[model samples]
Target: MPVLNPDIARAFDEIADLLEIEDANPFRVRAYRTAARLVLGLSSDLKTMVEAGEDLTELPGIGEDLAKKIIEIVTTGHCSFLEKLEKQTPPALTELLKVPGLGPKRVKALWHELDVETVDQLTRAAREGRIRSVPGFGEKTEARILEALQAQIAAVPRFPIAVAAPYAAALVRYLQNVPGVRRVVVAGSFRRGRDTVGDLDILATVAADSPIMERFTAYEDVAEVFSQGTTRATVILRNKLQVDLRAVDESAYGAALHYFTGSKSHNIAIRRMGQDMGLKVNEYGLFRGKERIAGDTEESVYAAVGLPYIEPELRENRGEIQAARAGHLPKLVAMGDLRGDLHAHSKASDGHHSMRDMAAAARAAGLEYLAITEHSRHLTIAHGLDPVRLRRQMDEIDALNTELDGITLLKGIEVDILEDGSLDLPDSILSDLELVVAAVHYRFDLPRGKQTARILKAMDSPHFTILAHPSGRLIGSREPMDVDMPRIIRHARERGCFLEINAQPERLDLVDIHARTAKEEGVLLAVNSDAHSIHDFDNLRFGLQQAQRGWLEMKDVLNTRTLKELRPLLAATMSR
Candidate 1:
């Protein structure tokens, strides 16, 4: 019955959605939405703080009323306000908001006009050509809705890596503390460092008498126990994340881990190699005619098949086996390799922290330099900087750099790439900064050719250093913009510009495949924590995960180089 941060956030988000659909006050709806974001972004556990009798109102955007609501939900596992809102409006209407082009207004229209309550109902209306009859919804909008519905139906729900980490780490810690438990490891996509995971596959080794299954099924977060056996248990957490736990003997531990931490194709390929060698491979062990051979360690399993142990992130059967055979597996980039982050924001823009606070946090994170890339003037909602303001900020950074120790601030702007591909700020202003992190802030639905051209043209700018979040994807919520990434990578290579592997959980842009493609094309990537707050510097880990999955080595990363070595490379991007 624990009310986790995500749980509270979801409640507030739902309340906001329902209220918006009901035509509630805009300020009230916005307050709930902002509260949800503040709760979700908190680094500490609200439940633990609540149990410790800490004041929840200390959290930004959480007023006295919201603080009481947080305490109530943590104590009772429900929020009365959200429950009442759900009663007033069909909760399913919130699902309509998830459709790509449908906003709260569109959802309200559909609900009030056609009585559409679910995706199925919406689909029916779309198919019957009835959605077009709704005011503000035309044939094109209806068609787009149908397309989005089909995509949603075909998609499997995935938890963002950041969202899943806490649950997985807590479970591992819990099991590790159990009596007679020898080892516990989270496997599957999590172990592979995937950007999103469907579920958790946990493996543990314990003494013969250990009551591991019972302990797992009794965990406080367990919403339902699907099945339980002496050595295995399957349960769904209150957050709807499914977890499967298996206890294996020490002898089969590595094999079991390998089997479960699989890209199924990778396992099949290894099993096929085992077959070629007159051996059988499975979760239990690698056997040569039932005379158990390698199973105690992952190295032994791979050695039995004449290959070195491949890193989990690269175990996708995507040339990994071949690379392993040829002794060519990459020394993937590690978190320690980064020297600086080139994309960040502060109170000068949409960011919550001051420039000094963000720099100090970066220094604490072992970074020697960090860029302060506030948004340019076009992003008015973020209070983006005009040329004069940017100049003033540049002077401030210069003063801070002289006063600070151990860290340096690089002046930069996340200059919006206009629809026609021009930088938001004039070159006269851009020339003053250390770097320019160009990005697309709007026009997400441009045709593939147009989008590609738009980005390509932006890169031609003398000051354009890195292409931030090249695809502009927001994980499950927003599909990546249509653009030719391969062409973009090639252009970057020719222009000596770099692309960013933005570390934000929502937009782990320049995803695994694209990162790898860039590496192969000889274009370096900056795995940047596009941090808006000091806590956001920790997001670099997720970025590193994405880079690792892309087969990136330290040399393939632009930010891994020391400042002495990096400045020259960055200078190459500027026009003479």
Candidate 2:
């Protein structure tokens, strides 16, 4: 068995969850949690490092004990520490952490008080009106729990795109290395760049004698082979992500790719277009009666239906077909189009790296300028900067810029938008910065009207430049705050401040629908990494994918403009 970084990271996270549920030391729990994050964010493979006998303790937040645990997980595919913790607490209690509003503390309370060790037990308790009496849980909390549980039950388990990417990329690389394989591609929601992916649809064009299926099932990470055939096979990975692989002939590769890389509605719409033209479309090819019309390329498939080639990200049947027909399809923003990132952080706040390191990283990532937006005073958990600390950091950035080249660092703060709609720090200090990435770090449960008003009021500030992670959502964990997003977009257009399409995988907020609405409203959106470390800049690709899905073009994105063009636009937002 090959242990990936995510495997090690998951072990650490589960250890943290179990520790928390046992009411263990908070610092010990935080240490494991931090170790998990560090593992997940590493660019290189931990297994490779372990194989090379590298010292893991050199990694941030990875101390002597934690380094040993990492080696144990990598070498043995299990963590003795986590196994021990699981024995002290019901291992299933960790699954309760998946429920939106339930944290480990709540799980512990449920376990000790209500004897609720699983979601099913919690669900029954909530339904029987027994949860309301469980100390901290009230009737409303119980009701919300029931609703959340039901939603969870109804939803298919989908991996966040970030979580699934490594597995998908590793598999693609493995298959590509197999003898007789010509090409391999992962197409599905992954191709569409959806925030969460249900499964991976992999297609390979191979020589007739290819042993792709045999090798695929034999891959180290494959947990179980569901079915196997010469041309097609299905399996589940160790992480439980289902994957389907198909060996396609070169002649029909494009058609197979398009068929599998689909939103069902989009595929149906394309098929109907083919039908109207007296043609048939399927996984193999597009045909007019007995003759094949198009199937060799995705462009040919679209041309057969009298449409231009639609980008996979736009293949959601969301007016894309109509736009293509009218020749109004957007060019769509790409990773190369971005000129700078407006929302980022450093060690001055909760970020793991310093401004100098982050700048060099942004330059390496091809950005001409990077904004170091540390969290402001209100977020103590992040060691957010006070006005004095913020000023000192600004001075540091100014000095670093004098010694640096290629990339410029902009001084800024991710100042909290207070409950009453005022900035966390006073305007006097905020006005001194190049930008303010105003955000809501707390009070996510406000009424729709109040939440919208709070955000709108914050944007009213002359110093406010962009709203960071505008919905404050963490996919599969935290739901988006209740608010009128269209109203927020319209207000942003009216007010001059921009909304952010935060690129962080967990917080791809200002989702595709909202991004499109902002575009429609003629409001520019910044597809920012909201990066906390150098590796986070890689997340910008996810943001770009999200923007493409929203039908955004380079001109529609704020940060796509060069620094010279962006400063004036940013200035307009700040002094409006």
Per-candidate TM-score against the hidden true structure = 0.96, 0.97
Off by over 4 Å in 1: 23-35, 53-67
Shift of residue 136 alpha carbon in model 2, Å: 1.7
For TM-score, the strongest prediction is 2
Q: Give the CA lDDT, 0 to 100, for residue 113 in model 1.
A: 94
Model 1: which residue pairs collide?
none
lDDT (Cα, tens digit) per residue for candidate 2, span 1-576: 888877888898899898888788988888887778767767778888999999977676778999998888888988898888888888999899998789888888889898989888988998999989988989999999899999899999999888888898899999999999999999999998999999999999999998899999999998899999989999999899999999998999889999999989999999999999899999889998989989999998999999999999999999999999999999988899999999988877777788888999999999999999998888987898999998899899899999999999998899999999999998789888988899999999999999999999999998989988999998877889999999999998889889899987778888999999999999999999887777778888888988999999999999989989999988887775
Cα lDDT of model 1 by residue, 1-576, tens digit = 756777888889898899888888988887898777667656788889999999877565578999999998999998998888888889999988999999989999898899999989999999999999988989999999999899889989989888888789889988898888999999999999999999999999999999889999999999999999999999999888999999999998889999999999999999999999999999999999979998988888999999998999999999999999999999999999999999999989878778999899899999999999999999997789999999999999999999889999999999999999999999999998889999998999999999999999999998999999999998877889999999999999999999999998889888999999999999999999998777788889999999999999999999999999999988888754
**Residue pairs with clashing backbones, model 2:** none
Please give the range of 10 consecutive residues that has the lowest summed lDDT in model 1. 34-43
